[model samples]
Target: MTTFRKIAALAVAAVMTISMGACGNTGSSAADTQDLVVARSLETTDMLPQTGFSNGDIWAIQQVYQTLTRNKTDGSGVEPGLATSWKQSKDGLSWTFNLRRGVKFHNGRTMTAKDVKFSLDFARTARDDKPWQFLFTAIRNVEIVDDYTVRLDLNEPWAPLPSDLSMSASSIMPADFGGKTETEFRNNPVGTGPYKLGEWKKGDYIKFVRNPDYWETGKPKLNSVTFKYVSDANTRSQMVQSGQAQIDEFPTAVSVSSLKKTRNVHVESFPSTSLIWVNLNNRRKPLNDVHVRRAMAYAIDKEAIVRAIYYGQAEKANSMLSKNLMGYSKDVKDLEYDMAKAKEELAKSSAPKHFSLTVQVQSGDPEKSMLAQILQESWKELGIDVQLQTLDSTTVYSNRTAGDFDVAMFEMTNDISDPDEWMQYMFSSSANVNSGYRNEKVDALIKRAAADSNQANRLKDYAEVQQIIADEAPEIPLVYKPGLFAVRDQVKDFTVTTLGEYKLADTTIARE
Candidate 1:
């Protein structure tokens, strides 16, 4: 059987299996229990705060851990998290955060300034493989001012320091936690959040139980939360439709339409800072040529893809920064889809007339597969042969990090409310996810934006950076896809934030 046929068969099998399970559980009492099961696409065995790179792992960490500050779901402001309040020095080089008193970790240890110092220091010095290490690079030193106060001194005036502290990777851990190695910490994670780690069964589900001594009283309405690893989109949707799972993340467009017809399911869509794009390996042959990269960018029909594949659920993106972000420029325009322009640019390149290239997509993602097929057809019109390669999420991420692909489909959420979080991580020459693309001018602009204390100066620097990136076309900006989730009707007060976080502390189940 061909690739398309094989994918179709797997999807059909998944739907049938879920349907059978739903039928068998019609009379079961699982729904009446206080536990809520959420189905997501990826499985992660490692739970270390600094090592989480995927959406699933980060989402899980948000529930089990607490950061110093929390970005508002709407992306308009920041709220207090583990820190009750904070102040900055006159020079903007030092920050002092006041810890919440009586906060207890999962292991029954009181969280103090010592734990805050340890967490920030660990984040700044973590291994290079961790993508979040750059977020803490500005910190020069972390000092425990007292039992409830900690100070961070930076090498320069980093304007987004507080926002950076809001990330899940900066979650506070026990200062004397007995974790000999990274693997040990992964196996037994501890935090001072509303929930505590309960059990983790690889390939199945990870469970978290409510913390009775949680700092916030009367929160974490649900007694327990279980995150089930369901890689198949069809199966994940079926699980929710059959009432087997209370929530599902990243549901397919088809599933969203079908679930709307059901009485007990609610499909919610929120504008997100997530950017899905086609990453071009700038160091690879043919792709290294600027003309070839521009040709590929002109060939993509982003509007059509957003319409047909996402069912008009997303907006066409023009740059790495989304419109909702702080530094997004309205002047940057998307390259129009024109086959004639694509051919013209290709003719000017030093690439062979006929060459085969591979585009990698995550396995079990129907939307990405459709996108790859669309690109394949478009590139064929320009006399380029394109191959679609489906790999698991882990392998796909690894290849992209190792610069082992000609082209790949990837997505990332803005780490914080600042443009520096998106631009620096995705386009900086020294960034791990740069995809072999580097420009000295772009790097300098990013640095200027991060260090500038003036708001207008920072915005001007970011705008220039976006213009340069648009001209070079390092990646084909696809769409600003909205974060969609399917929730059972009985699940009350549940919401998925624009930052791609699930607010479950106040979520409750309404019993019929």
Candidate 2:
């Protein structure tokens, strides 16, 4: 009763198994396994921008659609996805892509340059300050060169433009479908990817069907995938163990030990640099004080939390930036639990007696609750009342962007491998206006890092930026999370990335 799952080289298929008592289990075929069930701890409530489901749902719909280019899962870099190949001009401001020949949308219409122009333009024109909208604004404009050729004009000399094109949000859809109202498009999506949306039972399940002529040369092996949202990690894991589901994501660190001892379940720990931090809103009263922020940093015991909650599977992060990141510093010391310092800060702060602080916590995510409780107890030692306010992830994230909380804990996974990726989103004045954290020095350093293409020079600039953040104390760093995923023994070719995205295009499921 052992299942080993690995995502294939292409990350499309998966290897999974369901064993019965003493009898060995056998895997099913694409025709028979048309119902591939997956359970996730995160819920997909509505299709809004910036969330995994909002974007991932669009990606699924686009699989019925297609993109101009694809990041080959083989790691050779960006290659032909919906587009056969592409080339850039010497100035690097303009680029052209040769579309895949004879590719048709799920609606049976042929893909054309108009489709490319319409999709990119619509995403950009439909911009909001939300993160997804920010992603789209990077493209200056797009034009139709021919029925099969499309060109993109850049606003700046972006080296990662090709990689950005491969993002799930950059998915291309039918031109006619572009200008439709949100409600209309959600009802009927015509993508060029491998799977077509068959049915969406709001709040329950989203069913997909394999496109008969998916552009990837007779792949989409599993016929269809059924994503069932279960916000509870224990329940999701149980669904997989009970033969009700094939794959499940985000099992708690506590359940890892027991799940590992189980007969047929295979677990893989992905080393991710995604770090959870206590974002001290500078606009708030007590938290607005720098000493108060620094004292809260000294109050939390990083070692105890990592050991007790994460089971020593995670690394203690000293700086807001992680060690695995490019500008990581080894000199930053751990902020041990110091009651004296916490008291000193409480006294130093001119705020009145009985000062209260609120820390927003997502309803079901275990780490948030655990971290909040640990921090609450630690802060209580200094006669401070720290309250944990539990809210739905949607509400919590929304309020965070709106600058409505005193203290909040959130984790960030680097989207790209650059110093700017970490600094740009959090400290830059532009992002700060939205995220509610701004430092002039941080803004300058980020601008320098973004402008400098040289790695060595960029590193120096980012190192200074990190030191500024360390001193400013707008946010307190906690721990670098390790992503945990479980696959059935029959599943193979799976790899989890630091970004927490599970790409299943090349995985294959086999009999155990």
Candidate 3:
């Protein structure tokens, strides 16, 4: 067992007929070497590391980009990536990093302090409207101290800065964008990671070949990787079973037991800081009313969603934050599943009866659609006509950010293991997530927690924040869930960081 498994307050380790093997090349790659095929639930929305919004895009970015600091392989802490070492000031307002020399981007250009400064500065001020802007918002400036050294000047003592820097959003890109136009660079980005883009067909598949000049030696043991767009979870499962794809990510949680029964298939279920929820457009309509929001929350049966969707894999969520997160208060309870209470609350609201509204789901995501249907059926009982709108993941994310939908479904994952990762984006008035779920008290509390160095003080503030959110009902958090992935037995040394980072550098495929 890894250290994180033992120490993580919220992680459960469940494994059957699976063990992580040491990564080693099984054979030399000829043209005949089989590429590892992976099937996922959605087509990648964007290839650029910092801007990609979909799970498909994130999966691809993990393969092609490197951040300055990465989550430790065993879990829950930061480790070096592009930077060999870093030193933080006692005041936490400034930090210096010594970058690894000789590291080359896929374009064969060596990574330098200039690129680091540009990437950090760009991410900090790029687009205030983007959800990830919070990652770098505290950085006052980035200074290129020397050829392989850079320093970050902060506006405040940001404790999450190290973890934030490890995210794909913080990945360093070529300062010159490889001398390509922004549009061209976005379409074909280069990084100092183990894989380089081989081919990308929009709405179809993405191919990544091993980077010949990767800084890490004896890495990316496989010749290449193919991530095929298979939106349906069942088909993704079938693809893995039939050897069409060696791995399937986000395989329906309920199908895991059955999938594990198939020959040579292994199911990996591990703890994660994921909160599945229905995000109400608090800026719109009756949803703006706390009564209506709480009404919808009470109507939905969280237990049924767990049983039907997660099988035996999940626990009903208590509050917006997952149980694993710090300051997850046991006292802040979820609204019980009470249809009658739902009616009372609905009746109390201005849009009492025969009111119609829509809830949007990601078109091909089984979980989102099923969860929406569940909401659709129950919200109807309140005399609320619910319209089900199914859109692609890209549009779903765009609509949410633009506040263009009545309601939306999303399985929110923390980019880092910090409570503020979700707290700021989901509840803070300053966040551009478009939730419109604002409380000046919450805004004040979050502001205090972000700057406070003492965990004790932060925890007290966050607890109050959670209770306030529970009462307000901005989002109906359904479950505190686990991460699920189906892999071929031949794929060896398969492991993800506690933060759910798919670090493939040490992974290899075994011989038949």
Candidate 4:
């Protein structure tokens, strides 16, 4: 399917929440409410694909699914998950995975090649729109060689196929789980991950329990985990401090400051792969001009946003990729913040004066508000009036995909180990043309990186590609947002990964 159509479908899918059942500890009383509960500002919709895909949803599902390989929370590349061992063909068109035996799903089904085939095939053809679907589209098909062996056949030479499978979407599910409607599965679900879906009370909380027959033996450190969607950052922080929540994700810096004053909680940060930027709506007349786009970049100050909003948690971005990535280029620096330069570009342009644009951001995100305020003030200096609109995460993604907003701000991650996996989705004509961006040179470079397997060549090619995009100024780079997550002091053996995912298979929570 085309990227636009997929994004439209995803927008529609976001309207509904996944309904699941709640199961308490088998040995405890019904009134017991304590379970490694964590609070966050958003809730996930049920239409989420079975694949360990989607941006925000992966954080929750990371506890419920396992991939062929996993990242160690410290920003490392790919590591093992379900498949204990794997081998690739010399031609790089075929791959075989050797699954660890004695794995069982939450539904008591033995995990086998059939399940692997079912999970991968469903991800490739699932009806619901998922953000990471772009990662799996290269696969022609998957074949079950034996009870524990699976082989993947690709349409073309794709070296990153194994690393792509290491992502969330490649999580294996029971064969029977395939071909089911998203609505049906949302209400009732099963997986082979560490925890099983229990009760989901919409607008209240989602509860989970340890899976007795989980593929990984004798693990899942916590007895249970529950997630509550408390949209207010203050409320989420208070919950953690009051012992109502054991952990939380990205509490406001202000709230974190207060928590540090009294609570025994600990804060941890990992290198986030997300790159937040302004998607200049090129369909508009003035922004269509390269000078206007360049001017917009110069007017906004990234340093202020990092200091005032992020409190130095974020690193200013000059290129599409993060500094930690293999293909990142350090030659590009932050655009100079000069109102005089911005006015110069506006005067030079043949476009009319008094240009206006709208930026859509998430309502609850503090950084979004800070960015919006800064842009509004900075652009005003150049006789440009910009409107800032804040919406929920769901609304933001929906409008962005539909091209409803003129200029929008949001974040994107490098999902696979290779940059091609992400760059293709961003620059490919087939992907959602956020900002209505298109360039033949960018397209050619992305394809070249996809076909080339040599590490040195791929890096050079991708570096040139990033420089090309930076020069053209399609999307304005903002900052590499830090992955700030808080865990209770007692939650030992937990490692924060660069990809922002957790593998609970071997984790253990100790308490005296």
Which candidate number has the best TM-score? 1
For model 3, residues 1-512, the per-residue Cα lDDT tens digits are 12222322111121121112112322222214747877877687687766776566776888888899987754456788899999989988999999999999898889999999878877777674345777777899999999999999999888777778887888899896889977898899898889989999988899889998988888878788888888766677777776777788877665677677777778987677778888889888888999999899899888777766666588999798877665678888778899999999988997888788888888756667667777877887888898998887768877887789998888766666667767887899877385788799998898789888888999899999998898789988888877788887878877765556676777777754
* Tens-digit per-residue lDDT, 1-512, candidate 4: 13223333432322121101111222122114325667876665552445323455666666766778776555556777788888878987888889888888777777888888878887787344554666777788798899889889888777677678876677776786745565666566666778888888865677778887765557775667777877655556656655566667776544444455534567767677778888887767777788888878888777766666665767789887877665787886545667687778777776537877777878766556656767777777787887888777767766766678888787766655667666876666655347777888877777777767887887887888888777667788998976666666655566656665654555444441
What's the distance in Å from true for residue 166, model 4? 1.6
User: What TM-score does candidate 2 get on C-alpha atoms?
Assistant: 0.83
Total clashes in model 2, counting residue pairs 3 or more apart in sequence or in different chains: 43
RMSD of each: 3.2, 7.2, 7.0, 8.2
Q: Give all TM-scores, in the order shown.
A: 0.93, 0.83, 0.90, 0.87
Off by over 4 Å in 4: 1-34, 50-54, 126-130, 178-182, 283-285, 350-352, 505-512
Model 4 poorest 10 in a row by lDDT: 15-24
lDDT of 1 by residue, 305-373 (tens): 776677678888888788788988989866778878888989999873877899998987877887788
Stretches of candidate 1 off by over 4 Å are 1-31
What is candidate 1's CA lDDT for residue 126?
A: 60
| Cα distance off (Å), candidate 1, residue 190 | 0.2
Which model is ahead, 1 or 2, in terms of lDDT? 1
Model 2 lDDT, full chain set: 0.65
Model 2 lowest lDDT segment of ten: 1-10
lDDT of all predictions: 0.81, 0.65, 0.78, 0.68
Model 4 residue 232 lDDT score: 57
